[model samples]
Target: MRVQVVIIGSGPSGLLLGQLLGKAGIDTVILDRSSRAHILSRVRAGVLEEGTVHLADAAGVGARLKAEGLPHDGFSLAFDGRDHRIDLLDLTQGKRVMVYGQTELTRDLIEAREAESRLMIYEATNVMPQGFDSGTPHVTYEKDGVTHRIDCDFIAGCDGFHGASRKAVPDDAIRTFEKVYPFGWLGILAEVPPVDHELIYANHPRGFALCSMRSLTRSRYYIQCALDEQIEAWSDDRFWDELRRRLPAHHAEAMVTGPSFEKSIAPLRSFVAEPMRFGRLFLVGDAAHIVPPTGAKGLNLAASDVHYLASGLIEHYEDRSNAGIDGYSHKALARVWKAVRFSWWMTSMLHRFPGTGAFDQKIQEAELDYLTHSRAAETVLAENYVGLPY
Candidate 1:
């Protein structure tokens, strides 16, 4: 088979890229090792920046998001037994975030693609990108014991951290930077109302906790844990108790407890791969960068990557220019680094290090205090949280 572009992932980044390209009359074939059900079943971050919302709308997948996504103008930063609300709308001049699950967004994109009769190959084995660095790039994979090859003009590696896209690049050609946090986030999803209308990020004496939601009736909560913490060790009741202990008295008192339907422990890390473009192959989303969930930048970063890559590809085809493609890596990396710094800052401020001394605790407290009282500091946080321009 031959197409203009072959996308090696069905995640939000890949799907969104395909959607944008399709709208521009460019043909793309998406390939993934996982089944459609598995892709949709994976739980991911829910926060959406304004730029991401606009991209979704442009992709024609925002109808459901517009009707159902929760719009939050501010979120609470709870510390020292009280809540300090950072008015995101006011601080960022009326910009806000949308609370829509990544799973739903993927489904929306997939459905839209299917409606347009686009090609998507799922559950393909040994999917690999071949000759991306040479002229006439193509992809190869095995499906149902049959090997297949696809010739394409370009390849997009959106298959995430463990996928074959980055691995295909020569070690000497790509540079990577990574920082793994000493802790992980033990999170749970329950069918219960959220503790507050807006999200709450708490820095407690015990640990860091976050109260987020997927919708009005579904709550997503997290608390910092040791890197070696086991999911099997946490029960619903125990998880609730520990979470309550980490929040202010008011939130704890009003919190509703229930049996959790989904639970897991995810290690926190910030990772980036330099020179996102390798010849005809471009790394997008997790394939290029990763951020800690503290700042809610993970999915938004992926969307921004898609934005840059899609714009470049559209320009390459429509205007017959390679300028946008040539500048993709530099432009995307600039925004990527700023978010990395913000996520690192948020993680450092909120999380408790394993061997910190009394001075460290005091510094963290002083930093939070300053952030709450100083409008200048609040504006910085608000701007980064809502996402920088694409």
Candidate 2:
């Protein structure tokens, strides 16, 4: 079908963009392979930055978020066997982040979109990108085993990192920047109550273990591990033992254990694809870049990317200004690279190398000490964590 914009992938980026544009009276269509809409909740990214919350509110989609989300002024840094709480309100006055899961945001947007008549789609369909510069930008796929071709004025490739959008780019014009670590993180979801009110990032000889809770009753936590580490390697009993040993601020802190609901592993890597656009097709979210989970920049950055894109596309359509839309690729790269650097720094300083020498270990400890002792260092971390709008 032909439309002003044909957005591929119904995840956060595409759905949010479509919602924003549709509210503006801009016609857009969203196509995905899933037959049913799904919420992205019950996963990762417990920390939400200040800027992201504002953007959601601006789009008129923050009602559920504001009601259900928790407000946290700051987080704690654990080092030297002690807890140092950096009150974010004290650091960045008045700007607060809400603690809401990515899945919750998706569910809100999904419900909102279900009431819209303009956005159309076929879930559980196979889609591919082609024939963009040749007049009609097309997404070819099969729905219910019947072949179909979707034509549009422009294509939003929100299919994510593994989708076919990246490969559609001319190899000569693409620049791939990558930094892979020697480790990965094993994230855990437990029905147990949270160990702390705020999230904690602990740097120890063992690895960088993060202490985070989803709600008063549900908790989410992560521990650093080897690249080759298997889920079976750490049984449920062993997981709790290591968590208690590494995350406690002191002997007084109590970690009420609960049954784990889910667990999974994510390989640590920093990646970005250059030019994010090729003719009429543009990429967003994981389709364009990937970041380590250390800084909690994954979902926030994707939201930022699509926010810019939706505005740019509006400019292009309403005012006949292709420059704003054309410059989207370049504009998005600025924030992407900055987050890449911040995420890499957090990852490098916390995770342990396979053959970490004594000097390296000492340096890591020293860096942690400086982060806690130095006010400027603390401010930098707070600013990055609270998130600055790019």
Candidate 3:
């Protein structure tokens, strides 16, 4: 295979990058080791910040999104049986988020690519990126016991946290910053309407409960638990009982109980590797950084990276300037750090303390109370939650 850009992984980042590049007349090829198109259909993130919505439209993949995505002006924060709404649109001057799943977004991008000439390689192997200055980078992969090499002008590593691309970088050049939280999210996908008009993030002695959604008929929810929690230990009845205690509403049991499609422990962590570019290869999305899911910033962050990547690549092509490539790392990190802080804040405020004195929980509640009651405090939360300018 020969192309201008070779993107690894067909997840949101890789697929979206491919769509953007393809629309730009850049011959891009996406290679994924997974043999089948993703149909997991489980809901993940529903909140989209204003800046992200604008960028998504500019990238050309936002056409169907604007039409089908459910728009929300704000979301609510709940604690002590009280619900407080943070009006994002009012705070951000017309900025609003959408309720959509990462999976559907991925599917949209892939469907858009159908008319384009990009290659989608599955059951791929070998998968090593080689050569740079020679003007052609090598991507070796094997399929059905047959080995093949893909040549491209630049390679994009978007496979994500566990992919092989990160390891391909020379050890001497990689500088990593990471934080592994003591807790993990026990996420569940249930067939039920949302518990509230807006998403509710609740703090309880049991743990943190996020009231999120996939659409009008399905709910995407999560509760905090020890990182080592096992799914086998949580029976269906036990799951409903826990949810009832965490979520506050009439018929709380009905709000939680329904046909569930997924229940898994998603580890919460924040990580970033410096200098996202090496030779002719660029790492975007999860290959470059990861944030805890509390802020619903994962897909947004991934999209932002590609937005800059697309911009940088365009500038480099139009002006014959290395400015885009040179500043890529610096520009990407500014956004990364802001997201990490927001995720950390939400995580700490909602989850239970392991051994902290009562003073700590009281302090958290105080902080929460201030944010919910004070316009200035909500302005801060609204700014971060609605997104940090991109």
Candidate 3 lDDT over residue span 159-192, tens digit each: 8888878889988988999988888888888887
- What TM-score goes with each of the models? 0.99, 0.95, 0.94
Q: What alpha-carbon RMSD in Å does predicted model 3 have with respect to the real structure?
A: 1.9
Which 10-residue window of candidate 3 scores lowest in summed lDDT?
35-44
Per-model CA lDDT versus the true structure: 0.95, 0.80, 0.79
Model 1, span 1-390: residue lDDT tens: 999999999999999999999999999999999999999999999999999999999999999999999999999998888889999999999999999999999999999999999999999989889899899899999999999999999999999999999999999999999999999999999999999999999988788999999999999999999989989999999999999998999999999989999999999999999999999999999999999999999889889999998999999998999999999999999999999999999999998899877788779888999999999999999999999997
lDDT of 2 by residue, 1-390 (tens): 667888888777788888888877778888876644343433657567776777677667889888878898888877658878977887776666688887778777777888766565756356788887677678887777788877788889888788777878878978998888888888888888778888888877888888887787888888888878899888777888887677655622687776688888889889999888788988898999999998889888888888788889888888989987888999898998888889989888877778998889889889888888888888887787788766
Ranking by lDDT: 1, 2, 3
For candidate 2, give the lDDT: 0.80
- Report lDDT (Cα) of residue 301, candidate 1: 89
Going through the candidates in the order shown, the clash numbers are 0, 9, 0
Q: Pick the candidate with the highest TM-score.
A: 1
Best by lDDT: 1
